[model samples]
Target: MSTPARRFDTDVLVVGAGPAGLAAALHARARGLRVAVLDPRVAPIDKACGEGLMPGALAGLRGLGVTVTGQPIAGIRYLASGSCAEARFRAGPGAGVRRTDLAAALSTAAQDRGVQVHRATAGPVTQDADGVTVAGIRARYLIAADGLHSPVRRGLGLDAPVRGAPRWGLRRHFPVAPWTDLVEVHWSRHAEAYVTPVGPGQVGVAVLSGVRGSFDDHLAAFASLADRLAGVPGTPVRGAGPLRQRARRRVAGRVLLVGDAAGYVDALTGEGIAVALAGAAAAVDCLARDRPQEYEAAWTAATRRYRWLTAGLLAASRVTPVRRALVPAASALPAVFGGVVDALAGHSDGGRTTSARTRWHHLEGAR
Candidate 1:
């Protein structure tokens, strides 16, 4: 007698409830797939992040019928060693949204779309030729958007060794009026501070550093920023570590990895949300086409520029002289800097020029 076949609870099972996971659920459901999301946490989950959504990220969120309201960001400003370089978004304005607010919007949207979200932890993923099973739920495909230190990825044996210094992130909110619409990136010798205006009277400060220290210790490195935020009422500090995460591959049998689980470089470019959303879309598209193997290449194509640019910047920032000269270089070549910023914001001119322009932008940053 032949063995009995397994029954599927849903066509797609998405692990993790961050922006990437929720986006995957929404996309799969839109494609007429019975999607169910599993997460140990409840709705409105917050994390330490820059909290600035790029123009493309905002567009992606709108496409999913998720609306988030926050302060409008027109551009990015880089300040280092008494010099500054700023560039406006050629495509459109981005937004500075709180992580909790963004999560609430996505959760509501997912619920309205009829995507079933379960509050249970995923464990012991077992997949056969037919489907994948985790936590008593079986599905045709599983998406691991479980984040940088994804247990799912590790279970699937996809974790790759991360080289170089491990950088960490710390974030807190200050109850003070925003000074500018541009997201300000202040660079110090050992760390960089990202200040984003999430609301009319609230600004979020996120510090990225390779060294371990308290939030105040990291902030003290930025004299001007510390002085500006001095004596202001602030929220409790939240933190995330070793920003550079690597995965061996995005696809493994009936399972696929998305978001930070797929891989990550650094947040220096502030492209996390945009990249995660794109990855979610690509993964679902591949699954909808019944071609899970195609997801790896699709994800690579979608995020090539981001990976190259972010990795190059990280490499440069590690060197002392290059770190000191970054802002000045951008200031000296204003047009080039603007082009790079536009690429980072997901602005494309189309055709061969766009490809060539992107290469030039990447080369400039790499040098």
Candidate 2:
């Protein structure tokens, strides 16, 4: 006797199983929606990032039931050619975790919640108002959580809302002592590097800003820092080419876009994972209320202004004189500069104190 064909149905379908995709899956499940997640990778997708989650991200991870593995970074450290400053808040926390590990953890959490996940080499998604048909499975709603170059976003004919200036990033892991408990951004004429302690004896370095090269070449400049790695050899390196910060409109039309697919902010701020996770929750909220239209406004309110602030900062980094003038001034007044940093870190709700924060030095430090 022949067996009857089986049918698979779900409330929502998510593409790409990265942090953004996993977050969306978890959120959708939390909202009582049956979810299906598709990705090309098996469990964890290796990503090149600074490995630091801002406070905003910490909150998002918790909401999604994803747990980080290290002590929180209390604040951020800024370094310029001749000046260095640190921003610390009594309440904020920053944690470090490898991207692959974080992705695996979140993916597992999503699965435990009953989300149906598929790992396929390549099977494009065909989405419509009724559902998304991939291979043979169907889902009522589709979500695009793919990364910067998302095929789902392209298929939907949506463009990124904001465009980022050209910049490249080379990421590598080195066995080195902790430079500081906080994430550190070191700026130079050629490039800028971000250092974070992700493991007990491991630190991740990401070089962004100028010349594009391999991780080995990128670490050459930080000789003093590299020396620490001699005792503990360097691990394999990963790199992401110049990133473009773009967000899309119409994320939901019987569908939703989360994480890098919905929008991407410059990595200079190191808040991409947090944004993706938070965006996922917001998308789920809209879908639960039967108002997918709310996602655009909600996500924009959450991330657009932050993107603008990063643009100003990137521009500020371009001019040597401006950078020189701003560093000392910013360092002298922590409250002023730190507040702006905090805002960029996603502490503030609506009003951005960029000007107030940036010009604080001109107001009080010039004297």
Candidate 3:
């Protein structure tokens, strides 16, 4: 009663051609599985993001045989009115490429590796003992990387509602020469603006806050940065909202969820791409082993770091007194701030606490 292998359209059908979906297609094809990826749009798509790739993210992309170009980011810097702390990446530098550049590179890589590219939007999914079918293609297994508002997730009853006050992101690019190698985060009472050098003569600024007004209004929150790009020509603003999404379960039947479709937290940490790529690899690995259920656990472990860190930081960022204390505390204990930034950069596993600092320094400085 076995169906002929040729009868199947693909071994794995991935919906959405964004970085996560394309990454999944490439990874699946590498394992010798026939893969097809579907998307509703053409290549070089753009979206709102912090756009700073941490060192780990850059390395992961190269591992999948992808090469992209952008400005080199050496580290991260946090600044407030009268407080500042910074850290340099101990692993290596990360790139700050635009979303369009990344999408183009990934699309080319997927085609080069022989992944079937379908330019169609996937509709309601129907599955049986044979497999899952969507948009006329019958795939033995399905991977949904369709993004935050995934129709596949909804059709499959996998969506989960998130609580708390919603936060959103707004981003735009400015044509101005880079001033620093580090990605600077300018925090204020109402918003946090991330300045990423995306090219030698262009920088992308993203602001995160409770739903806000014009980009000019958000830019004004960062006084010094606002002054530098006062009238610089910029790209049209792109945005994403309420900033959090989740799934009831990552794996259900022969289908698995990846990227924002699987779940998402606030983008305050800039780890979205890295975590998505990891989930893509993990989901494909499960299919390769014919143990699709194991992907749930794998997904959990893969995203544990991002989830915990973003959650804790976001929760702290919400508290009035604690939020007010952040920059001052970071400024007072510069070493601790460096450690946290290094952890975020994938240098230390967030395990190397600053308590390791020698007491001799304290005594010497006291004298």
Candidate 1 per-residue lDDT, tens place, 327-354, comes to: 9999999999998889888722122222
User: How do the predictions measure up, each by TM-score?
Assistant: 0.93, 0.85, 0.92
Q: What's the lDDT for all of these models?
A: 0.88, 0.70, 0.85
Q: How close is candidate 3 to the true structure, as a TM-score?
A: 0.92
| Cα lDDT of model 3 by residue, 1-367, tens digit | 1346687888999999998899888777666678999888988878899899888787777767788999999999888887887888888898899989998999898888788888998998989876989999998999999998888999999988888888889999998888999999999887889999999999999999985788888888788988899878878888888788889999989999999999998898999888888888889888877889999998898889889989999999889888878887887888888777776777221211121122213433565
Best by lDDT: 1
- Write the residue-wise lDDT of candidate 2 on 25-117 in tens digits: 776666556788888677878888888888777666665556778745778887765587888755577787888888878877876778888
How close to the true structure is residue 51 of candidate 3, measured as C-alpha lDDT? 91
- Candidate 2 has a TM-score of 0.85
The positional error of residue 338 in candidate 3, measured at the CA in angstroms, is 2.3
lDDT score, residue 72, model 2?
59
